[model samples]
Target: MTSQGLHLIRGVSHAVFRGQHDDRAEECSFRFWRCGKGFEISVDGRDVNHTEFHLLWHQLVDDNSLQNLSRFDKWFRLWSEWKTLRDVLHCPTYTLKLAKTGTDMRVAAHLVAGPVDKPAYDMLPVHVSDMDNFAKGLPVCGSESVRPGSWLGHSPGPVRGPDGRLYTLVLCEHRALDAQRGEADMPSWDRIRAYVHLAHSGVDTHCIPRLSSLVTDGGLVAGVLIDHIDSGSSVQGLVEAAVSAEQLLSLEHKLALWRDRITLTVTTLHEHGITLTTPEYGSTIHELNIEVNQHDQVCMLLSFGTVSIVVGQAELEHKTSDMDELRTVFDERLPELIVETRRRLAAA
Candidate 1:
């Protein structure tokens, strides 16, 4: 989307503060813009010295102190602390309220002084399209129809799309892009597109999260929306619970079933010319999600993690290595977990 398109979706307002700091009169004004769940605040005084404010802001960000404080408290400290900005008036308190317009939400800032409550100030809503300038020029397949929605919770969680389906937005990691490489040549995009291909390759998608759409901003690929998997339903959680309960026989039987399903999933991916990249930790079993049917039988083995497309003959080694590592997990890790659980039980 262009800047003009962004302005169509934004709301703007201004506010001024006047007070005395250390027996000296002070005054400052600020411009606030609110757009698509983002807020931008800018100081608007012409002759005001903002050296102290900039230094204090950098200090808070460097030590990560601002992250520990609430959003309102962060703004409050930045605006009200005289040591941070002497030219700015110290406002004692403030109130924040949210107003909803259809599916979109807007925030209103109100300054409170003693017994008086000032009218809520409107802020310009900055366009969400400006968030990812680095990914500009990367081709996005069918991204024109994909509408990014507000994050459901913390990032990497499900985001409700315009289609009303829950999707996990996987942002392209910065490290995946090489400095000398063009954005279109990034391996991350290739991996993402490979997954999208696998989703529609007529294989059983029950064991994998299907790629719904690619998220883009300003014609650049920013991220992808994939089917959301509940982390609570992972096979690791089930195995740990079975070990704690000392259901050795049942645990072994369930693991056998899961192993077979995983084997089939790996085979399917290999056939599609995709390689399951072994994570840095080397355990793929933790990424397996399980869903049981009404008859209490394991129904699905949802694979959730990183994967890459097999390009060269040398990259084919990943296929065999992935299978071998999974086998080791089932053969060694499962028994070790059982032994540890029993030892702890006996000691207790």
Candidate 2:
């Protein structure tokens, strides 16, 4: 059927671009929706650079439609045969490329979750203050807490300012400049090194859906994207300052631990054909890069130290790399981190 089908994600808001699996990947369009936010995506259309949004769809798609094609009609019959032959199916995702303006265009159907699942997170007082400060500055970015807020995780009651404009900070993360969150036990070195850029509080980490795939234990794992040209996040600048701060040496123990995890990651990467070898870490800033060969294509990278996994890219990227080797690193080691962290807490 030439006509595309749509799937509705109740709380996360948006109709999935359930389209015909054919050569015209560009023809597949999507509608993104969420709390007071909405947009559409397609080739040469509006906002082509929303890479993460496309990722969210690929990682989280409602295939309930798979059961609805009951008609033995010719259209359904033809489509069924095509679906059965597809070795790898995609859910949905966006990839922003350089537009005519030299800026990346977000091209994807991405929407905010109406009854969004903004989970509670742990945070420090100092961090919360920064998030509040950022919210005040970026009047157009994300929704801020009504009164109280945090240094980690999403806030509540995102409202359109009386300015009568509708804008949302896609997704952001709030943690230390070099901090990362995942199943706590042993940090997956390669995964951690995948995305090294730190996020500010209140910045939607799911901004572009980069890290939504691999961590989908129950569909909560996703990474945020940042619109550098348009943002209200002090976290980016703050992360830079934190890294180069000589005082950061005071947190040496934490840094050393992070390095240990990172080192293990690099070694493992080498063992598999993936190369993360690059720039010396003389500076505190993390400019790490993860290069992997996917489907015979070399040097596909994401942010270093980013512990996210989406299905599409990985299918193409890791298809040639050592998947078992990589998965073993996280699968076996993550549990260890969880146990050790608990032990430390118990002793304390």
Question: In lDDT terms, which candidate is top?
Answer: 1
Candidate number achieving the greatest TM-score relative to the actual structure: 1
- Lowest lDDT 10-residue stretch of candidate 1: 1-10
Q: What's the lDDT for all of these models?
A: 0.43, 0.28
Prediction 2 TM-score vs. true: 0.19
Q: Which stretches of candidate 1 lie over 4 Å from their true place?
A: 1-155, 177-190, 242-248, 278-306
39-93 in candidate 1: lDDT tens per residue?
A: 2222212222344443433332232231221222223322221221101111232
Model 2 spans > 4 angstroms off: 1-249, 278-301, 304-348
Candidate 2: worst 10 consecutive residues by lDDT?
81-90
Provide the global lDDT of candidate 2 against the true structure: 0.28
Predicted structure 1: lDDT:
0.43
lDDT of 2 at 163: 38
| Model 2 Cα lDDT, one tens digit per residue, 77-191 | 1211112101001122233232233255343223332332222221111122343343332222112211111111222112122233222212222343333334332123233
